[model samples]
Target: MKTYPVKGSVKLADGKPLASGVVVFAAPEMGMEFSSPLGDDGSFVLRSSYGDGAPEGTYKVRIERDPSKADSQARGGRKSAAPAPYPAKYGDESSSGLTAAVKPADNALDPFVLVK
Candidate 1:
């Protein structure tokens, strides 16, 4: 098996650390989709399930939080089941906050920033 490394940072619009989020990779032209949830530090390592990694190209990545987790809190024992404050959006190289294109040249892209 082979693996490729990719680094990232997840944060809210306020510039606060966003502990959890999903990074989706889709190559519509090739009918492929690959995604991974970010770590606490908002970093990720993208690889292929079948060792068929993402092809070198600009892809539209959608990011969002886990649906199972409740994002609300209350003073009492009760908890708010409010819907997620942040929705997902499709991102390209330019929109992904990368100085370089989201291709294989340097094999790395800039940290993606998500608005609150």
Candidate 2:
């Protein structure tokens, strides 16, 4: 298999699940990307290649949903306040003790947080 699924929920700043929306994953360095659809439960899953995960760098993630699609696709999700902010950070590596450029296919990017 060349893919795996990542499960998570899209929640509001208030910590409530967002019924429907779209999440996009972009890794410029590795040129790999993915996206997932938010279900009524505000949960989603993005596909990652065999060993492809978020690299050790910054990412620009956006969440937007077509309201019109709601009537056609909304099983039980909400129309969200607004697509969150432009560019949310994911799988950073600055916090890690090791300081090196990402080398995917062999090295894994550990947990790192963005310094907003």
Maximum-lDDT candidate:
1
What clash count does candidate 2 reach?
1
Q: Give candidate 1 regions above 4 Å deviation.
A: 1-4, 68-80, 85-101
- Which pairs clash in model 1? 13-116
Worst 10 residues of 1 by lDDT: 93-102
- In the range 38-70, model 1's lDDT, one tens digit per residue, is 776777656667543455665666665654444
What is the lDDT, from 0 to 100, of the residue 36 in candidate 2? 63
Error of 1 at 97 (Å): 10
Question: What would the TM-scores of all predictions be?
Answer: 0.64, 0.47
Clashing pairs in 2: 19-77
lDDT of 2 by residue, 10-109 (tens): 5654556666666555555666555667787666665455543344444445455635555555455754344332224322222212232333333332
User: Where does candidate 2 stray beyond 4 Å?
Assistant: 48-60, 67-116
